[model samples]
Target chain A: MEPILFTLFGAIAVGGALLVVTRKNPMSAALSLIMSLFAVAALFVLRQAHFLAAIQVIVYAGAVVVLFIFVIMLINVPENRLPIEKPTVYRLLGVVAAGLLMIEGGLASRNFSAPATAVGEVGSVEAVGHALFTDYLFAFEVTSVLLLAAVVGATVLAKKKI
Target chain B: MMGPSAYLILSGILFAIGAIGVVARKNALIILMSVELMLNGVNVAFVAVGSYMGDPTGGIFAFMVMTVAAAEAAVGLSILIAIYRLKETIDITELSVLKW
Candidate 1:
């Protein structure tokens, strides 16, 4: 059951990601990214990170994607108005560079071997919350400050006359 | 069940594809989306590693990452909007004010 779920959702996630990069239409690409994010959330569930799964849905699928759609709609770039690139050598070089990156990353991951240590299960809401409030408390509080700064920065950037 | 390495490899592919999107695409919005893709890819690997080690740290780190991603999206979109208001376009190539 777990294996099947993994295969199905993994395929969906990767396929949706592929669609996201390939689609010319920003709206369509955004929708595909949303789908991909949902599938990744499923992967998180399979990993027993139930709280992360929920947060993934709420934060990414709900908020981030909506923000993207809002901007895409707000700007309203028609299909023909999308950026057009000349068939220059740089485009080919970019593709080659990315392909090399993929290869390097794949090889590195394949080489990573960790000893299988069996221990108590983690990732439940209670366990994660304990970790967050205890060992991670300082970082958690700092994140709040970072978020506040981000909010202020965004507001200032969006303002016309600052 | 698949090993953690399989998940890592999938994540690597996802990240790489996102890199392709970022490097190859012209639209800044798509580029930002690709950046999100790259973040997601890393998130998978982090969760997989945490699960393998029976630790909640991976999930905690992922939470931090999500928070950062949201903050980045907010700031990035606002900047994109300001750019659009000025040049009437969000093409990264067009906004080469920093290009030497």
Candidate 2:
């Protein structure tokens, strides 16, 4: 049962990612990204990180992807106006580099050992909140400040004028 | 349960795909999305390790990564919007004034 679920979600994640890269339209790509994000969230659940899965759905699939779609609509880049250039040297280079990275990363991960069972109830919201408020308090506070800065920056940058 | 290596390898593949998209795509928006993909890949790895090691700290770090990712997406998209307003196009290849 577990392996079946894993395979299903894994296929969704990888397949959606492929669509995100291959699609020419920004809106289509954004939609595919949503699929990929949802699949990743499911994978989180499979790993027993329930809270992380929820956050992934809310922040990523909910907010981030919607933001991308909104921008795509705002710009409304005409399909014909886009260059639609033929494959070039950069495309080849990108494939080669990506292939090498995959090889290296796969080799490194070969020694990883699976945990027989979850060590803690880290998947629960309470457990995560406890850690966030206690052990990671400083980092959490810093993240709040970072988010505030990002809000201000986005508004200032996106506005029509000062 | 699946081994940590499986998740890690999946992350590697996803990250590589994101990297390829970043390099191959011309649109700044697509590149930003690709950046998000790479970040997601890293998050998966963090969670896997944290779960395997029996430490919640890895999950904590993944939370931080998500926070940073949100910030990055907000700021990056805004910058892309501003750039489009200025140049009327979002293709990074043709808008290379920074190629000095």
Candidate 3:
């Protein structure tokens, strides 16, 4: 049962991700990205990481991809104006790199051994909160600062006049 | 039956596809979507590892990655909007102002 769910969500994630890349329309692409993110969140849930899955959907698919779609709607991009150049050399290089990466990944995967079972008390929201406050407090604070900087930077960039 | 290795392999393939999309796509928005694909691939790998290792740190890291991805999309789109405003086109080839 778990395996079936994993395969289903994994297929959804991969398929949606491919659609995100293949779609020509920016809105479609953004929507496809949202689908992919949601599928990934589902995968997280299948892995028993409920909090991460919730955060994934809320933060990534909910906020981020919507922002992409919003900006896509704001911009007046004509489909015909897009560059259609077919650079054979670049495509060949990309294929070669992808193949090499797959080979390396397969080789590395051979060494990965799954632990006995998924028994972790730290996956609960309470445990996560404790760790965030105790061990990862500094990193948490830094992330807050980073988010503030990004918000300010985005505002400045979007504004026409200071 | 599927295992952590299967998930990891799928994640790798997805990441590679995203990388190719980023390199091959001409539209900035499409590139951004490809970037999201890559991030999702990483998140899958993170969760899979977390499950296999019996640790929650990987899941937490995936959450962090999501937040960073949001920030990236916000800032990237805003920059794209600014560039579109100035040039009236989002084509990367035409934005070569440094070309002599």
What are the DockQ scores of the candidates, in order? 0.73, 0.71, 0.66
Query: Can you give the lDDT of residue A141 in candidate 2?
Result: 95
lDDT of 2 at A121: 72
Q: Write the per-residue lDDT of candidate 1 for residues A55-159, one digit (tens) a residue.
A: 999999999999999999999987888998566676687678877987887777776765577735577899899999999999999999999999999999999
Record all residue pairs in model 3 with backbone atoms less than 3 Å apart, i.e. clashing. none
TM-score per model over all chains = 0.95, 0.96, 0.93
Report the C-alpha lDDT of model 2 over A1-162, residue by residue, as the tens digit: 768987899889988888888888888889999999999999888878999999999999999999999899998889987647568898899899999999999888777675576477766688788989998899999998999999999999988963
lDDT of each: 0.89, 0.88, 0.79
Chain A TM-scores, all candidates?
0.90, 0.94, 0.90
> Which runs of model 1 end up more than 4 angstroms from their true locations?
A85-87
* Model 3: per-residue Cα lDDT over B26-99, one tens digit each: 77778877888888788888888876787767766876777788789888888888888888877676778988
Interface RMSD of 1: 1.6
Best by lDDT: 1
Among these predictions, the greatest TM-score belongs to 2
Question: Candidate 2 has which clashing residue pairs, if any?
Answer: none
Query: Which scores better on DockQ, 2 or 3?
Result: 2
Instruction: State the lDDT of candidate 3 residue by residue for A1-162, as single tens digits.
Output: 878887788788888877876777777877777777787788777777777878888888778877887787777577786656466576667667877888898998888988677467555677667767887788788889889999999999999953
Tens-digit lDDT string for candidate 2 (B1-100): 5677878888888898899899898878888999999999999999878877877787898999999999999999999889888899988888889899
Worst 10 residues of 3 chain A by lDDT: A82-91
